[model samples]
Target: MDLNQILAQLETANDEEIKSLLQQYNRENSHTFSFEKRKKACAKLCQSVLTVLGRQVQPSCQKTCLETLRILSRDKSVLAPVATRKGILGEDTQSEEEERVVVEALKCLCNVVYNSPAAQQVSVDVQLANGLCASLRNAREWHHEVGLFTLRLLFLLSALIPDLRGSLRREWRAVRLLREVLEHTLDVRWVGPYEAARPDPQALPMPAEDNERAMEVLKALFNLTLSDPGGEDDHQFRLIAALLRHLLMLKTETEEKQRKHTGDKSIQNRF
Candidate 1:
């Protein structure tokens, strides 16, 4: 469809239809759209919506459309301008509306990594880390949530990048940094009507669930390296070996616990 037709649809279509159309447009036309075209389209579409709807309530359908823009960002054609958008970059002048776009963009980026074929083909783990690092480095105080969400998603995507030499060092450090930041932001509580807003200090905490997820990412990275066993990448091999040792230690503890639990169950049965 022509640009006019597409823009018209974006303005008036039902939420589901709008989402579908946006995705289709992003996927099919991304390669073909000129740089100027993609830039203008993104800026215009995002601006128009923010003007009309504001940011308080993000409709599910609009969420999908925003995600489609994120998918589009995978293309250099689309990514450069969006990343460099006056609003997305410098923190000094970032408004809440701009921050909303950044957050929505990250949500889309996460969805792409977790659910899209594009992520599989695009080395999402590395690229996602880079994107989030940039966001965290650039975020303003009001947009701290955006940085937090990006960090959370990076923590998840770490599961998919295979371990490489010196990989553990960087990966673990990143997780540690994220945990520290989450801890620093720790005012969210689980009581009362704010239950949904409660922070899982465990997953985002040191010596807690965050450590577990970090271990998971480490294991996944190690597995990826092991799966392709070739002439050894010495540093990777050493890192993997270290992680394996740590895992074995945990496994021993797990087995002992299971044995104890089983024995407790047998005693109950006799009673």
Candidate 2:
């Protein structure tokens, strides 16, 4: 299909057509389509799709557009928009859907970082973290799965790059935003009526395992920021103290809940 047809398909097409358009876009222009190029195109098309969907009477088209962005986010190219000065992924200049795409793209980049070393090599962790911080608060209506995924990304990121942690320590907003989300994860309100609302916390179902992983990531980030002997004299002692306190509380809460449940079962058995 021609470019106009492709763009048209992207805006109005069903799932299959959207996928096909992406595939065709990639296949035909794979070599020439640099990450920046794809990002620009995605940004432009994403804006158009959102504009069109926004006017529609139905919600499905808007949802489909969001879903398309979610899928496109898997490509590293798509995530680059967030890191740009224009803040396409950020709340600074973009519309809601545009920002949503950027958030999804960041999550995708984090997954790529975990799964592939090459992608991480191409990114500067501090820049990516800055982008992520910008997205977190703005996406209050974000899907819970996206929230959970973003949290996991934060965990992995804080672990993978120590330098980023140092930058984050100095960057109060980034640190505060992350702490807020960490607090949210601990909130009962975060748990909803259905299984879907809760973040699986566990890569497995066992809470301890998930918490353990979370601890590892946090510890890594902390060490990067506060544990470097040559780093800084201040070493962010206050921030580290707060993080340590939070970690201990989380552990204590988890243990207490498990113990209470186990005690209840034992009492029932004795009866």
Candidate 3:
């Protein structure tokens, strides 16, 4: 079915039918549906997913809807509907078994904001930075399955919207939260004897399983401070500088880590 017909079906379709129709669209034309074809219907199609989300339908069905959006978002022109939609990037997403639905939503957000300045702005207007920060609030409840995409989108926002960096730092305490998450995810902690902070590493390459999440945090930190006019004594600067001391202490088989690390050993090279 075309976009309009399928949307009409969504108004009355059963749970299984919702999933089947969404999946069929995703399979057949969510991609091939073309930008001009979807331009007018994009908002309706996006709302259809949200409408499905509003119902007490199966999580699988919600995921199908989100997955379809994720595919449709490949066309940046059609994302205004998605960009203006609040909660699309927020933390209230349904966290079912494995939090599949939540991950799917983040993936959609990543697709929406990865290159669209318009979507990025709307995401900021909706205060999604706070929502993304909420995802890391409780370490025990942290969604490990959703880690990469969450941090990735957060990084994109911080990078794409220069104006948002300050809010993310102050309003959300994002600097501290990101630091805590990096420590927790990497299982690293520094004890006693503090070392002065230093410059960030040029590259943070490591095994995908080992460093992907850490890399995401590093990339976000770079953007968060990208245009910082602050000096060394600045609070965000200090905290990250302190983090620099420990980040360098990590034992990595890669020379890039060793050469660029911020621990004591690098202090000698600093001067």
What TM-score against the true fold does each predicted structure earn? Answer: 0.36, 0.42, 0.74
**1 or 2, which is superior by lDDT?**
2
Residues 152-176, model 2: lDDT tens digits: 6666666776666766556634544
What's the lDDT of the predicted structure labeled candidate 3? Answer: 0.69
Better of 2 and 3 by TM-score: 3
| Highest-TM-score candidate | 3
* Residue 230 C-alpha lDDT in model 3: 59
Give me candidate 3's TM-score against the actual structure: 0.74
Clashing pairs for predicted structure model 3, backbone only: 248-262
Clashes of each: 1, 0, 1
Q: What is the C-alpha lDDT of each candidate?
A: 0.43, 0.47, 0.69
Per residue, candidate 1 scores C-alpha lDDT tens digits across 1-271 of 5555667776666656666766666676646534455676755654443332332334554455565555554444434323323323221122234556557755555544554444533533334455554544443343454654565556545555544223433543343343234323332232432122333424422333333333334333433333333344443444333333322223212454434323333212211
RMSD values for the candidates in order, in angstroms, are 13.7, 11.9, 5.8
Q: Give the lDDT of residue 199 in candidate 3.
A: 28
lDDT of 2: 0.47
How do the residues 1-271 of candidate 3 rate in per-residue lDDT, one tens digit apiece?
A: 7878988888899999999988888888653635665677866787677667766778788788788888877877777666664535432445344478878878888888874777777787777788888876764455565878888888988888888888888778787788777666555444533444232355344344445576677778776655555553265555555555555555565666555443334222321
